[model samples]
Target: MADQAISGDRVSGIEDESDLKRSITGKLLFFYVLGDVLGSGIYVLIGSVAGAVGGAFWLSFGLGVAVATITGLAYAELVTKYPQAAGAALYVNKAFKNRPLTFLITFCMLSASFAAAASLAQGFSDYFSQVWELPPPLMIGLLFIVVLAVVNFIGITESVVANVVMTVIEVSGLVIILICGAIFIGEGRADFGKLVEFNAESSPIMAILAGIALAFFAMTGFENAANVAEETIEPQKTFPRALVGGMIAAGILYVLVAMTAALTVPIGTLAGSDAALLEVVKTDILPVPLALITIVFAVIAMVAITNTCLVALVTQSRILYGMAREDVVPGVFGKVHATRRSPWVALIFAAVVVGALLAIAGQLAVGDPAPGEEKTTALEILVNVTVVFTLFIYGMVIVAALKLRGKDESEGTFKAWTPLLVFGLLANAGLLVYSVINDPTSLIWCAGLLALGGVLFLLERAFDRRRSESV
Candidate 1:
């Protein structure tokens, strides 16, 4: 299909008509993208990626960022063309006009959001335990979700503002890691040779690919920005730059952090701990008191996880609200609070589901361990599930972008390179297949979630039928 263009005037008209507050400027949107992309995945899963790729995990992060950026370009084009909320589902609906497919995509996005939030909540509890002897980490994780929901319920402006502050703090925490690594190197304790080493148990290609699958989690939050496109001021002009720019910036920081971690600490130490970055803070080369820095770093890591969870909730609620307006889901999800201007019902539902996920996942044993592999935790299971769902949604979005080409011909609409979108689709598919093959448990989790979506879809359809019969 031929690509189309969208005029600036139509885009402006759509933005002016949005119900959500347009409080997010170019600056806030930049941080929104940055904060989301730089979230808890790195803080929590750096160890998992290291385990997959050995000491050369930074390469996985770099390649993951590159693929995510390519996919982000496709989103940049679609969001500017459509300039509305609901993200991937919205794009897919526009391209295909199939209700079942649209609802499935919507549910996939929602499911991914729930899993991501739950995983981050787990990460938060992991860090929180360092500050206090918080037994029963699951309870703490549940409370974390509740607090985020409350923050989301207040309003969008308040939520994004808090996101900005948290983003700054998280970036500072990462910067501290870089600084400590520099000092460690100067002291002659760093081992730079590990930067090129791969896991001996697997081929270099398999190892790096596995690492990319985990590291891609850190690159995910950029897509959440598209769900708030309606609330972004002048989205067509603002989104392209902010979205792509934020992904690139976050990618660079991730590589640097990974390199520093690999050089400053032994690969075995990093690969074994859940709080891999915290191990960097514990490095004795720092001039300050070790305990003080460790505590401070833990707080910052919790803040970073909170920021990502907040963004994920925001995106989930918006997806429900947007899909409701399209009649792809129940109309109640579209209800906005009278004063708060937030989707309170959707927010509450999302929070409840995330809590349930945490409870259920905690009790259940997920995938079996491979030879020499340790049994997976609830957090790792959720992370793998989230990655699978996100990769599916991303691949669909690129295909949708390809299908929707030439449908919008107005001037000033952003367009992704056609070849890059194709490459992104293949890359996403490859990683998704690899994830399922490596851990079949992820497929089970995905199936269970999609089965839930299927149930909801049928119920919504039955309700619509009964209403029409009454009329």
Candidate 2:
């Protein structure tokens, strides 16, 4: 009954009569997924992966793709079944019907998006600083967040097109790295054996698992794509293909890029630098001009950061819009601009949080050292929280998929394998364990965030009761 033959296209789920425009085709949706999935994660997290697994960093990325695939399949099933916005939070609400849990999941997702946007803003500042001296990086980073917020408020169609352009620019950087590695190997200066070598840090299995925990963060932007399903044309048909195909493409690209990085540069060198991918190009192995290549890297790095930030803002605002519609949050968040049809109120709120976080990261980057503190940047702390909360959200989504299975047999044509759903649950739960073991600080940060969600939920309930009494 859900799959009505609407003009023979086999539409499932209620058609969205929202202000959101259905301009996203299968091709545009493909680019959207490709762009979001191929975000700053690979550009920024490669060094961390190398630090954990040494030269065999590709293994971690490979495992990350496998883990992401399991969840991606679950997402494909649910997004098509629901074919609405709000993504993971919506799925959670449908399965459990628990307001508190749904609020927590939704809040955690918003927190993750703000943290991710801040991280990307800081990344943009770092790369821009490489090209020109920034007198105050914090101010520059806040400016970046502001720019993204403005774009997000304009319209979804415009935002996705910008993402497509930026995606092309960012993917070019990876292609160049691969070509440089090929040239290096041809000259017999690269060590092909390092491709399989793991340093003496720990057992190989533990190292790969550790690396997978970190690498998993790089593959997460795919899930956020579900938030835009409402804007997608024939979402039930296109979402599953875009979500799964995009992940596969990004996974292959990640593996190839990781192998090239390990083969072309020493693991120690790659592990030490935050801008490790740039090192591959600037190395003597490549005959390109150092200044030209550095500038190119700087430009592409900014593009990557901006692309990810834009997509994050889009999803975060949509999640807020979805929550507001459900009365899980303030109704103001659901308001769409009359002309642009964008979630302007939600965009403003998301921007304020992201901008504040960026300012904090900027201060942490430049402020004088505390007496004995390790001088960690706010971006570093927030990225860890983002990873932890993201895994938490993913775990709940897989559970929701299992619970909702067969409940609506006609809701979606695609069904995730039950075994894979179980695997996804274990994998996400295992990653959460690894995250806590590796960085216990994440547990504290996530706890604080969840507590804030609880407080907000109670406030909303009280306000709703007050309004009803007045009536």
Candidate 3:
């Protein structure tokens, strides 16, 4: 059955004939999903979740893992049914066959990637600040994006290899936090009672819901794995286990890390901090020197952020390249570099948009606020925008999965339980609606990004019409 699908892809000139190199094996792909899912969100947003739900924030992580896994089941089934890049957009296009709706979904995915990369870049700057007080954070973030772009331009094999190395370093940092927490418990200093507590200001239900919205960011990069299907070796055989298995592993680690942070540090301290895990390390439970551990963990946090950002760039480029092949966007985006075989045009475009977003966000966040004004930072705004965009995309993917069910009932193709996909769709919709209601400002950012996508869509249509007339 797998052989039949591979031959069909070649004859139909679908993804198997793609110019992108197929260097991602089952092992590399496993690390790719694990690394991407375990990236910067936990490092940077753990405090935000703590602030929302107090010491019991690990419950939110647990719930988020459940929601994400449900969505992962949908992705596992769809990628096997129609193994290709473009991820959600491709699935939607196949299910609905609506060009405009397909373009909207594609742009939403692209915009989400842009916002996520910018958010991670901000996180990288925050961690870099802990190491040295050299350049301003905005400058550091801009430079970070440029360096990752260069790494991406080199090749997918190189990029995935880098992600694997960085994944190890970042996971080590989390393990250290867990070890420190255990030591604190053994010393009879931990407040295990706090683990069940919720924030006093909000109802327990609201607090948990809000924390899940933020924690969902940590579970996102799993879907990005779908965009690399064309580059993966034997995707039908490799993706189901790798994608779902990686998410389960990352989810367990996230919940454990959250528990450790709450155990080792005071809830007030963890809630107040931006680097929550670093605070856990600062408990001095570990025998290492305070300064040495702090600096080492800071470097590890930056590496984690870099790994996620690199995978995002890879997803964004593949999205454009895939859509272009379908004539849903400009043909130029479909062009691949001769020697490198990378989607050079799409890669550069994604990098520039991310850099521009950072610059614009920095400008908007500039200037001191009046007393008691409580200004929102660029990172906070981007994080909310990313969550909103991703939730909507996940919901649509589940819908697409339902629509495409039984369309290609080939043997060896994975199938998610129908009822689970329905539940996942509702969960995503609930979170998305809740987020927009609480933070209406995110809607404005989403609107602006979608408006830009609309403009690009119109321009592409105009260009295609002109080219057709000349021919």
Every candidate's lDDT: 0.86, 0.81, 0.85
Better of 2 and 3 by lDDT: 3
Q: Which lDDT tens digits does candidate 2 get at residues 250-295?
A: 8998999999999888888987775778778878556778899889
lDDT of 3 by residue, 360-457 (tens): 88887786767876466777778889999999999999999999988986887899999889999999999999999988989998998888777766
Candidate 1, residue 19: how far the Cα is off, in Å: 14
Deviation from native of the Cα of residue 412 in model 1, angstroms: 1.4
lDDT of 2 at 274: 57
RMSD of each: 5.6, 4.9, 4.4
TM-score, candidate number 3: 0.90
Which residue pairs clash in candidate 3? none
Best by TM-score: 1
**Ten-residue region with minimum lDDT total, candidate 2:** 1-10
Residue 185 lDDT, candidate 2, scale 0-100: 81
lDDT of 1 by residue, 185-302 (tens): 8888777789999999989999999999998888988888876787888888899999999889899999999999999888899887868899988877689999999999999999
Quality of model 2 by C-alpha lDDT:
0.81
Candidate 1 lDDT at 9 equals 44
> What is the alpha-carbon lDDT of model 1 when measured against the actual structure?
0.86
TM-score of each: 0.91, 0.88, 0.90
Lowest summed lDDT window (length 10), candidate 3: 1-10
